[model samples]
Target chain A: MRIHVQNPAGTSAFSFTRAQWDAAVKRHPDMRDLEVTIDNSDDGWSAALPVADIVLTWVDIVGAKLRGCDLSHAAPRLKLLSCNSAGVDRLAPFDWLPRDIALLNNSGIHADKAGEFGLMALLMLHNNMPAHIRSQHAQRWAPMHATTLKGRTLVIVGLGAIGGGVARLAKMLGMTIVGVRNGSAPHEYCDEVVSVSDIHKTLVRAEDLVLACPLTKDTRNLLSRERIALLPRGARVINIGRGQLWDQDAVCDALDSGHLQYAFTDVAWSEPVEEGHRLWATPGLILTPHIAADDRDRYNDITLDILFENIRAHAAGRPLPNQIDPVRGY
Target chain B: MRIHVQNPAGTSAFSFTRAQWDAAVKRHPDMRDLEVTIDNSDDGWSAALPVADIVLTWVDIVGAKLRGCDLSHAAPRLKLLSCNSAGVDRLAPFDWLPRDIALLNNSGIHADKAGEFGLMALLMLHNNMPAHIRSQHAQRWAPMHATTLKGRTLVIVGLGAIGGGVARLAKMLGMTIVGVRNGSAPHEYCDEVVSVSDIHKTLVRAEDLVLACPLTKDTRNLLSRERIALLPRGARVINIGRGQLWDQDAVCDALDSGHLQYAFTDVAWSEPVEEGHRLWATPGLILTPHIAADDRDRYNDITLDILFENIRAHAAGRPLPNQIDPVRGY
Candidate 1:
């Protein structure tokens, strides 16, 4: 079976080089036995698409209008499409995806990086690092005090790979975790589990709130202004999920008013935030420019590892762990 | 037993109020059985010190020329001096402390807070949060990449209560810990233990270096300019120990030259840093204004708990857990 790797242009961190592919192949030598093709430019896709049995591409290249790149038209032999992102939120309502092809996401690949970032964000928020950062920049000697994370309540929305990773680290640090997800299934890291409908009542208990669920019809604006008011004063919010998952203006307002002590958002309402945006200088807020989970050096390797594992499972007629459930739109 | 509690003015976080004393007494009701007298002024110390068998005061109260406050002459009845600080480096040589008096330093009280702060500083350094803070302050959307800390090497100097706390958390995060202390005794959290003499050679292996040793004649300027040069390029430095332990100028220069990726120093060469100090605006450096380990709310409770435990041990003719060894100066 032939696998075509699409190198999309203009994606800096996600753009994997040929050397990275070689390095990944060194880790998974069994891939050397299979037929693999790569393309760097727009024209290369026209040649690579028709005969490829599998496509390992970034999520950005999925709905692109490149010549002969349409999966339903030119890619007649395509059986699998592996995306390099944990959240396939953008490709939701997978109407563009052909019925015959199975989709796989790089889910667990980001867990390690996300988990570390999540832990860092939680600690930073708890310890009032954002205010200290502001004081440092202002050439002030103001000192803020903080309590320990132990015995504090953490209400995490979404018990998927990213939230679960955060929960595990928080649990190890001796925090009481209350997990909110689409379902009420208990998670090992969470002391208590509640469904999305119960989130309104759960917010009052959240000393630290983490948004890690996928953005979908049910999740968009999950933490609205009304919901933001439900959280206890001096609470912290960390968003490793999509930007649309929260009401950005409400977050900024809460931070400005000191209702929310601190908030760390790796994402923003819009990429490349506009000048004079409130988020740029919101008090007690830290903007990470959406670099939380993506590991620069190991992204390609982990993505390929997931792809290879999926390939092995596919050959053995077993289920793919990273396979997406289209009906759920994640 | 007569116990004098000296509450010094102007010590914001460390100053325990009467309400705090009552709260602590609620935690340890047995303390109420003893004759505990609190003095909040210079005159009060003079009155309480003369008749006191035990003195509980801030480290700042030591060596003060207050009338009837001299442990050597005015307070002849004193047998135990319980200080609120973990490090009694200032009261070294025991010249002022009566030879008959056994001193206790609040060591384990700060362990939990110090451990949490150390972990936060470590994560911040590894993830390059200093750079991100700069970017945010400048209203720039620059994105920097970072690797996970799971496999990194952390070399910590002064593996006492504070250092051991950092080690425990770092070990939980899966980093290899190399501890440098006065002795080579194996630490449960440390993968390897070495004496302070081997620190120069061990600095090369450190991706993260922590200064948690006590300030002493032997530990002064431990991480000097030459030793700082020995660290691997891009290594992060965390100074939770005394400011005198490291050559602050050398750290600033390393950060300026990009030889060091990041450094977090809660302690500074001179705190409430003078205007135009390089530490105020050192690139890739985060100056936290010396508030790393002190919990504002729980500080008194923990300190009182340690005092009560020490009192129990002292009454039982057992070795005091917090007693300071003057020969070591910590």
Candidate 2:
């Protein structure tokens, strides 16, 4: 059984010490006879692999690197494709791969960090931090009444790992957690769960809405102008998921008109946003370079743990954890 | 027994209907009659008998009114003085008044509202809400990292009613709550309590500090420049109490220098702070026009409850609740 490791650009995984690699190798004794190959080239997957059983891939940047691979040509011996990312959208469209090839994802890796960011967004809006900062700079004490989360409603757009983490924390803070997902199912942390179809109606009642869904064909531009307009005045929003899921122009217009009191986003349609973006000039807006899930060490450690556990399960011929369904696009 | 109601500036209590006053008088059978009088006139105290059993005074604007009256002349009749406000600063320097006069105040009236404001300030600083609002108006999706409260430390400067309320809520959110008061007594909601002498050391370890202490002669400018400098960089501060406890120039300098991340203040040293105040130009500072305890209906109800309860206790020859020690100036 041979293990093939494909490294992504800018990943620090390449700097792993030989001693660490040996320790990891020793943990998997069943694969002691395995020949490991570290490939970091465009033609890394071009050669036919008749004996390769497991493929470990760490791709952070979305685009051609992971998706451009021709998986159909060498699907026979590929037992598993473990991705070091929570989102598998980049690999969703590939239906030509072997049916038996198990797909595992690092779902738990980013949950805590992303959830922390979500909580930050909720609290910042509730307290009106940005206005305070501006006031400090102006040496002006422009007093404003701010809202509190104790009796406010928080609507979570998705209830997966990241959203679930957020819901748990918000519930702990005495907030009413309302979750909106594709199906109507009871979630542990959510006080109420509504179907995605009723999202517009849900928005009207939510004091704060968190966008935590994946960017899929069904959810693309989910929070459009019509939907955003349904929210109550002074409602705050936080987007820690895909940016394309929201109608940027509508959000901007609502914010400018003071219809939506505040918005905190950690994801953008484009990375490293250009200068003079509308967000830069908008009042009551907080912008940061996309670094919400930037605890690289913790994320990598959790990802590796998940990968190791899955590998052990595979060796024992048991079902792997965090198995992703290509059709679901989670 | 008879009751004498004195209000220097004509209390809003006078707005109560005659029927309502009659109903209250009927409820307390120990009182034979009720006399409402404006205490602003020089001869106001002369009209009331020296043997009047109970006196209720409403003083909206603190200072002078309570001190100007010759309470010693009316001490024989004035068994109890029920004040309408929470702070007894205006009634301080009470040595000149009758030593036996029992003074009761409405201390817990603003608990919930002020607590909510403190929570709002914490959320705003943690989530950077104002920046997000600004971003939304610009139609920009700027991603930023936010701090969460799950594992942060909160240091409360005062552990009185308002501080206690804030500590309770913060503890529920999984934060470590530290309190600073005049003594080192253990607090119910706080994990640790330190004396005022240890405040500088305590500030160094706090991630978020709330100033809820009353402004007394000893507490004036309690958070001096040297003390503010002891705080860790990025520490957030919220002042729901009198702002005189914090040196405005020190806070402004700290915020401008990025030594302190944020400050939320509901009360300032001066009301309607002058246009060129340093607080107006400081960055990451939130100013609210001292309205944290402004839930009109709730405030009125609490005040009435305190007054009614104190009156009942006084009529029954019981010790009054919330008795203020003028020397301490609580």
**For candidate 1, what is the DockQ?**
0.75
Residue by residue across B189-229, what tens digits does model 1's lDDT show? 99999988888889998999999988988999999999999
- lDDT of model 1, residue A275: 61
Per-model C-alpha lDDT, please?
Answer: 0.86, 0.71
**Number of the top TM-score candidate:** 1
Q: What DockQ results do all the predictions give, each relative to the true complex? A: 0.75, 0.24
Error of 1 at A308 (Å): 1.9
A261 in model 2: Cα distance from truth in Å? 4.4
State the displacement of the C-alpha of residue A270, model 1, in Å, after optimal TM-score superposition: 0.8
Q: lDDT score of model 2?
A: 0.71
The sequence of per-residue lDDT tens digits that candidate 2 reaches over residues B1-330 is 555555464444333334445555566554334465435444655565375666555544224444576766645667677666676765656675566777777788767667766766786677664454445444565554454575789999888888987888778667899999998999999999999998878988999999988778888899899988889998888888887888887887888889988887788887878777766645577676676754443444455556677777766788777777777876
